[model samples]
Target: MTEIVRARGLVKRFDGLLAVDGIDFSIREGECFGLLGPNGAGKTSTIRMITCVSPVTAGQLRVNGMDVTTDRRRIKATLGVVPQDENLDPDLSVAQNLAVYARYFDIPAAVARARSDEILELFQLTEKRDETVDNLSGGMKRRLIVARALINEPKILVLDEPTTGLDPQARHLVWRKLRKLREQGITTLLTTHYMEEAAHLCDRLVVMHLGHILAEGSPQDLIERHVGGQVLELRIESDGDHADALAALRDRADLRLEDVDEAVYAYSTDQNWDPVMRDVASFGKAARLRESTLEDVFLQLTGRGLDE
Candidate 1:
């Protein structure tokens, strides 16, 4: 697949503060590429530069072979952007919102109407076409925002925290639609802090922290590389037995431990967990063994939770 977006030594600054500090990454055509990190991790800053919303303070940024610095107009024309904030017109009906946004791209009125109907159906918002934005539920509003972004039939879809603040059912609905879009060959660039969202939707991703890339690979690859195959989470108590449990885990060369607030996480590639489990059985209230996930990889690489 050809690279649709690329950056090298990219930097962003607001006065003296450095947001994105000399980073490099690329997005291939028709793949869902994600920038995963916590708040202020430069995910938003990097995407802003790619979408031409913010100026790059230094380094090279390109979209579809066009330079971001000199080709802002051409670049913006081929991009569909869903910002973090809800910018839908509250007074406009659902159908009207799409129609009006289409004008910005110079889409013909008749063609815009046709595309609006098609996209509304794609997002399952056909029944809410004539309803005002203010009348829709949070999920409906979110779907509409995404629907509006497609009014231009863009080549690359750029979403910044598209599922933020949505309930589980609503968020899942959005996820389903995005998956459908990817199946139809729309290259997507997504920035999100939600581990599950990134794991579920991204074909490949780069973990960003404090303006730099920590690791890049498929979700499963990162999990295997960072935290291994299985995780054993043991609740930690202040009792003397807990110290014994920690000491026992440290004695084993195969196990890696991370001590969080109330839990001691044991990571290992060994499938035989019997010996490890017995050592921590009496040390805490509970113990759970499960498959390692993207969250575990992020915590291992960053030494903090996603929200932190």
Candidate 2:
């Protein structure tokens, strides 16, 4: 597979604060790659460098084998970006929004109109074609924004938290549209906080925290590697009686333990999970055991701190 985007020792800083601290990764052509983290985890900063909107502070970043510093225009020409913020022209109708954006790529008037109509139909927004951006529902506006990004049929689509604030129905619709984009072999770089979205969409992904990549692999691979096959959450009622039991639980059976707030998260393989839970019961603590997930691995590496 061709490497469409590559970064090595990439760094970004603002007023002496390191935002992206020397990270390395590569993206293959026609695969969906994800960047995931909580708020302020440098996800947006890394994307800006990839999109050539922000200059790299240090190290090399190449898009389509061209350096981002010198070949920004060329790189951007092949990129279609849907930012976390809706950048649609609120005053223009849905169809006009796409037409105006198509001109940015120097698309011919007739071709722009045709592609605008085509993508509108593709995103299921043909009925809202003549409606003003402000009149459409949040979901319709999101569809239009994604449709506008494809006006130029860009080689790479960069989506930053595309489904952040949408309702469940709207998010699912957006997911369906993104799945279609993937089926079209679009090389996509997506940043989202939703674990389910990452697991469902990403072919490969890296977990980022504090400007560093904590782990990298396919979703299931990362989960199995970092978190084992299952997670047992022991939420002991912090009524003083469970303290000794919790400590004893931690030392039992060579288990990996992460203490977050009031919960002691334990990781065990599926083959040993039943016996592990049986051992925990001897400590007189009630625990809930379930399959380990990407979220479990994320919190384990990044901690439970709220990034606000």
lDDT (0 to 1) per candidate: 0.90, 0.88
Candidate 1 regions exceeding 4 Å error are 269-272, 281-285, 305-308
Per-residue lDDT tens digits for candidate 2, residues 247-306, read 656666657777666777887543467666676675454677778888988888788888
What's the alpha carbon RMSD for model 2? Answer: 1.7
With a 3 Å backbone cut-off (N, CA, C), the pairs that clash in candidate 2 are none
Q: Taking the tens digit of each residue's C-alpha lDDT, what string does model 1 give over 72-103?
A: 98999999999999999999999999999999
Worst 10 residues of 2 by lDDT: 239-248
Model 1 worst lDDT run, 10 consecutive residues: 236-245
Question: How good is model 2 by TM-score?
Answer: 0.95
| Highest-lDDT candidate | 1
Q: Residue 199, candidate 1: how far off, in angstroms? A: 1.0
